[model samples]
Target: MAVRKIEHVGVMVSNMEASIAFYRDVLGLELQGTIGHPDEAIKLAFMGAPGANETQVELVEGYNGGLPAEGKVHHIAFTVDDLESEIARIEKLGVTFIDPAITTLPNGARYRFFYGPDGEWLELFEPPAK
Candidate 1:
């Protein structure tokens, strides 16, 4: 079977409100929806990009469960144009960047990595102009 696109990334947060604010306000993600899984005693919040994109970030909270890992899964990256502005905006929200903007690879593709509320890593990629 051919592998399809990723539906979403699940992240567990101790506080759902903070997670929502950080993602919605800082990252500019829209809170598509949220649901209460009574059976599991967990709440799931789905967020999507502002413009055009189906990829989503699922915030799992109130479970008091185990954490996956910090930087172990590495990070989930998304394409962005203004890395500087994005970084500044997120930093103002108290988010920390693991590594500031760095240019690597022979092609000199610009990219940066950062951490969210629960230390979930994320990468922002800015591709070379075509």
Candidate 2:
């Protein structure tokens, strides 16, 4: 009950540059910053939509990137303004889609699955408009 909200989701990545580009350029998330772990030799990067008090995406590098067949994190979903436009844009960027088509929820929300640069499952969710 004391938890305010989901702060961030950390994703393990092999190549920081590629992963950063995918999340920032392809996914439209602004790169807040990147730094080398002081205690460890790992690298860390944080990104999120500007001015949006939403869950942040943290990309971890130099850690264990040996992900399982399904990847480390099950999936991370990003709220999008336009599902159709995002799908088309992602396709144009040649990102691999895990789901063949967008799925509509009973409440009218729509979503589609796609893979990130590190094979992490990512989702684009568009809730029904008010």
| TM-score per candidate, chains pooled | 0.48, 0.51
Lowest summed lDDT across 10 adjacent residues in model 1 is found at 1-10
The digit string of per-residue lDDT tens for model 1 on 14-98 reads: 7889999999999999988776553356776878997746678878776545655552233466666766676677778887888
What ranges in model 1 sit over 4 Å off?
38-40, 65-130
Range of the 10 consecutive residues with the lowest summed lDDT in candidate 2 = 1-10
Best by TM-score: 2
Pairs that clash in candidate 1? none
For all candidates in order, the CA lDDT equals 0.67, 0.75
Error of 2 at 10 (Å): 0.7
